[model samples]
Target: METTREGAKKIAHDSTVQSLNQLLEKNYDAENGYKNALTETKSAQLKPYFTKQAARRSRNANELYKAIRNLNATPVEKGSAKAAVHRTWLDLKTAVVGKNDESILKECTRGDITAVNEYEKVLNDPEYLLDSKGMIRQQLHNIQISLKTIRKLKDIVD
Candidate 1:
C-alpha cells in the first residue's frame, strides 16, 4: 500500500538521522576525553622544565641587569655600543639555552630585538654619536638571523 511505503521511507530517514546523531555524539565525547588526557600529560611533562627554566631565567635577568648598569656607568667610548649589544646577546643566550620550549628562546630573542631598537635610537641621535654604530647594526642583523634559526627550531620542536 502507498501508506506502508510512506511509513517505511519515514522510518529510514529517522534511522539515518539518529545514526548520524549517535556518531556525532561519540566523536564529541572522544575529543573531549582526549583533550583532558592531553592536558594532564603535558602538565606532567612540563613541570621539571618549568622549574629549571624559572631558575635559569632569574639568573639571566640578574646578569642582564648588571650588564645594563655597567653600560650606563661607562663613558660612551669607541666600540662600547658593540660591546653593549654583545652583552645583550649574552643575556638572551643565557636565558634561552637548554630550554625545553624553544619558543621561550624565540620570545626572549624578540625582546632582544626590542632592546636593539632602543640602542639603535641612541645611535641614530645626533647627540649620541655612538661608537661603532655600523658594527652594532651588523651585530643586530646577526641577531635577527639567529632569531630566524631559532624560529625554525621552534617549528620543528613544536
Candidate 2:
C-alpha cells in the first residue's frame, strides 16, 4: 500500500510539474506579446501601465499561491482553532495584497514567512497532529518553494 501510494504521489507530482511549466510558458508568451505591443505603440504613456500590469500579473500569481496555502491550512476543527487559522490566513492575505499593490516582492516574501510561522503554530498546537496536517502543510510548502523559485527568476530578469 505504501508503494502504491508513493507511485500515486509520483504521478501527481509529475502531472503538476507539467501543468505548471505550461502555465509559465503561456505567461511568458503573453508577457512578451504585451511588451511587443507596447514597443510598437506611439504612446509612451501606455507603456508604464503595461509594465505595471505585467508585474501585477506576477503578483497575482503569488496571491493565488497564498490563497492555496490558506485553503489547505484551514483547521479541520472549528471554534478557537478555526478562528486562529482564519486570523493568521487573513494576516497573510493582507500582507500579500498590500505588498502587491505597492509592487514589492517583500510582501510576497512576508506572506510566505507568515505562512511558515502559522504552520509552526499549528504544529505546536495540541489540537492539531502532525500526521493529520501533513498534506495541508505540504501544500503550503509548495507555495514556499514556488515563491523561492519565482524570486530567483525575478532576480535573473532584473
Candidate 3:
C-alpha cells in the first residue's frame, strides 16, 4: 500500500542510514588507530597527543552511533576487519623494529585522510538528509583538524 513517493522517501532514508553507518565505522577505525599509535610510540611528547586523538575519535564514534540510532538504524560497535589487521601489523612492526614516532604519525595521517574522505562522501551525497548535514560538517571539521595536526607532527619529526 506504499505510494511511489513513500517508497522513494524510504529509499532515501535507508541510504542516509547506510552512509552514516559507514562514517561511524571509519570513526571506529580512527579510534583504534590512534589507540595503537598511543601505545606503540616511544616519544613522551607524542604519547599524550595520540591519547587525546584517540579519545576524540571515540567521542566522534559515539556521536555517530547516537545519530544512527536516532534514524532507527543499528550502529556497528566494532571497527572493520581490515582495520583490526592493520592495527595488528602496526603492533608487530613496532615490536620487531622498535617504535618510531614518524612512522606512527604517517600511519595516523593516512587514517585521518580516510576519515575525511568518508565524511565527504556522506556530506556530498544528496540522499543524505539535510538535518544530518550539520553534524557531518562539524565532524568533518574535527577530522580535518586531526589530519592537520598529524601532518604537522610528521613534518617536525621528519
Candidate 4:
C-alpha cells in the first residue's frame, strides 16, 4: 500500500509537469506572437498594449519554467511548432491583405483563448495539485482579461 501510494504520487507529479510544460510553450508562443503583432500592425495606439502583453507573457513563461523545475522536470524552452506555423500564417496574411487592426486583435484573442483553455484543463485535471492549481488559475485569470481587452479593442477598431 505504501509503494502504491508513492507510485500514484509520482504519476501525478509527472502529469502535472507535462501540463506545465505545455502551458509554458503556450506562453512562449503568446509572447512571440504579441511581439510579431506589435511590429506588423499599423495601429500605433495598440503598440503599447502589445508590448505590455509580450512582457506579461514572458513573465508568465518564467513562472511556468520555475514551476516545472521545482517539480524536477525539464521545461520547454520555446513555443510549439504549431504556434510557429500560426505566427507564420499571421505574417503572410498581414503581408497579403495589409495590416489591419481588427485582424491583428483577432489573432491575439485567438491565442489568449487557447491559453485560457489550456489553463482550465490543467486546473481541472485529476492531479489533485492544489499548489499548481493556484498558479494556473492566476495565469488563467490574466489571460481571460487579455481576451476581454482584445475583444473591446477589436470592437473599437471595427
Candidate 5:
C-alpha cells in the first residue's frame, strides 16, 4: 500500500505535470497564432516581428516539453482543440473584416495574455516542484517580452 507521503507526492507530481502540459499547449497555440499572423498580415514591418515571435514560441514549447519529460510525463504534442477552434474563428474574422494590423496585434496580445496566465498559475501553485520553477519563470519572462512587443505594435497601429 502506498504511504500517505507517497500518495501526496504522486498527487503533487500529477498536478505539476498537468500544469506543465497546459503551458505547453499555450505555447503551441502562440506559435501557430504568430505564424498565422505573419502569413496573413501584409505589413512588411509586422511580418518580421511575427516571424520572430513564432520562433520564440516554438522555443518556449520545446523548453516546456523538455521539462515535462524530465518529470517523467509525456508532454502534449499539439495545442488544445479549443485553441484550434479559436484559430478558425480568427481566420474567419480576419477574412471578413480585412487583415488589419491592429486586429492582428490584438489577437496576438490575447494569446500572450493566455500564456501569461497559464504560467502564472504554475508559478503560484504550491504543489509545483522547486526545480521546475526556474524554467517556468524563464518562460514567463519570454512571454512577457512578447506581450510587451505586441502591445507596442498595437500602440503603433493606434
Candidate 6:
C-alpha cells in the first residue's frame, strides 16, 4: 500500500540505480578497451599511458559498483558486448587505416568520447539522486582530464 509520493520516490531511486548500472557497464568497456589498446600499441610512450588509463577505468568501475550496491542493486560486473564489437571494428580499421600511435590515439579518444556522452546522459536526467550525481560529475571530470592528456600526447609526437 504505497502512496503516490512513495511510489514516485521508489521509481526515481530505481531509475537512479539503473543509470548507475549503465555507467558501470561503460567503465568496464573502457577498462577492457584500454587493455586491448595496450596490447596493440607499439609506442613505448603510449603503453604506459594506456596502462594508466586502464587502471583509472577500473577504479571508476569500482566506485560505480559501490554506489549501485549502496542503493541495493546488483552492479553489473561485466563489460558490454558493444565494446567487443567496437574493438573488433577498430582492429579491422587499423589494418586498412593506420597502426601507428596516432591512429591508436584517435581510437582511444573516440572511446573516451563515448564514455563522456554516457555520463552526460545520466547527469542530464533529473530523476537521478544527488549523491550519485556528485560521483558521476567527478568521473566525467576525470574523463575530460584524460581527453586533455591524450591531446598533449599527440602534441609531443606531432
For each of the candidates, give the backbone clash count: 0, 0, 0, 0, 0, 0
lDDT of 3 by residue, 49-81 (tens): 988988988888888899889988899878899
Report the C-alpha lDDT of model 1 over 21-71, residue by residue, as the tens digit: 322232232223223223323345444433443343333334333333333
After superposing all C-alphas onto the true structure, candidate 3 shows an RMSD in angstroms of: 1.3
Give the Å shift of residue 109 in candidate 3. Answer: 0.6
lDDT of 2 by residue, 1-158 (tens): 46987776656544333333333333333333334334433445445644653564354334434433443432111123333464456457755763222223343345445545544554454433233345445535654574575466446434
Candidate 2 TM-score to native? 0.35
- Against the unseen true structure, what C-alpha lDDT does each candidate score? 0.41, 0.43, 0.86, 0.88, 0.89, 0.89
Model 6 lDDT per residue over 26-105, tens place: 99998998898899888899899999999999999999999998998899879888888878887888789767777778
Determine which window of 10 residues in candidate 1 has minimal summed lDDT.
73-82
Give stretches of model 5 more than 4 Å off.
Answer: none
Report the lDDT of model 2 for residue 64.
31
Between which residue pairs do clashes occur in model 4? none
Give the least accurate 10-residue stretch of model 6, judged by summed lDDT. 98-107
Model 5 C-alpha lDDT per residue in residues 52-132, reported as the tens digit of each score: 989988998998899899988999999999989988987787668787888889889888897888789889999887878
Which 10 residues in a row give candidate 3 its minimum summed lDDT?
Answer: 86-95
The C-alpha RMSD of each candidate to the native structure, in angstroms, is 28.0, 14.1, 1.3, 1.5, 1.1, 1.5
- How far out, in Å, is residue 121 in model 5? 0.9
How well does candidate 1 score on lDDT at residue 36? 25
In model 6, how many backbone clashes occur? 0
Which candidate tops TM-score? Answer: 5
